[model samples]
Target: MASLNVYSALVVLFFTRAAAMATKENDQIIKDNNCETKMGLPCVLEAFTSIFKTGTISSKCCGELVGFGKVCHTTLVKRTLENPLFKDLSPARIIVKSIQTWNICLALIDSPSPSA
Candidate 1:
């Protein structure tokens, strides 16, 4: 029974990591599509937004989220700070979590995907 409990915990840990990675890739996709439309890539963002569930960004989206790791990060930190979410979150902790999530998706995308 103890062995089974340990195995279950490990599996849970693995899936949690998997989900985090998914979020990261999704973020990149969103950022990419956003840039295209912003720069006047005709019909790309419109086609993406019309179907995207998050109603935010696309799966093929790829690009550096502007102002990330710099002023934007600091800006979000301040915003999340004043907002109720970060009263306990703290800026550093939230950033660490964001990195971890991004890494997860990157790992999947980098891996030997079955389709390949």
Candidate 2:
């Protein structure tokens, strides 16, 4: 029983350290890529809502998000999922939504605009 408890504790400690290290690495990536400054606050909020809830992203915001780059977008989403406020959310579902949002934004940015 004591050995089992020790094993469980060790497993918990290992995961905690790993999660911390991942978060630190993600923060560095965000900083190096200037992820925070890439998009305006309103667009960022729109992207967040589009991924975290049932919402749509505007063409302008989609352009901002596409310009934000996939690496930065993915890192930001992963970091946001680490927040306690989103604890109840399903990571898998959120990730799928994030990918969907990125794809939609990418398509929007790549598509040609109508001529006047």
Q: Which candidate is the best by TM-score?
A: 2
Task: Write the residue-wise lDDT of candidate 1 on 27-46 in tens digits.
Answer: 55546544333322333343
Estimate, for each residue in 1-116, the C-alpha lDDT of model 2 and write its tens digit: 99999999999999999999999999999999999899999999999999999999999999999999999999999999988899999999999999999999999899999999
lDDT on C-alpha atoms for all candidate structures:
0.43, 0.96
lDDT of 1: 0.43
* Model 1 ranges with Cα > 4 A deviation: 35-116
Model 2 accuracy (lDDT, Cα): 0.96
Instruction: Rate residue 111 of model 1 by lDDT.
Output: 67
Candidate 2, position 14, lDDT = 100
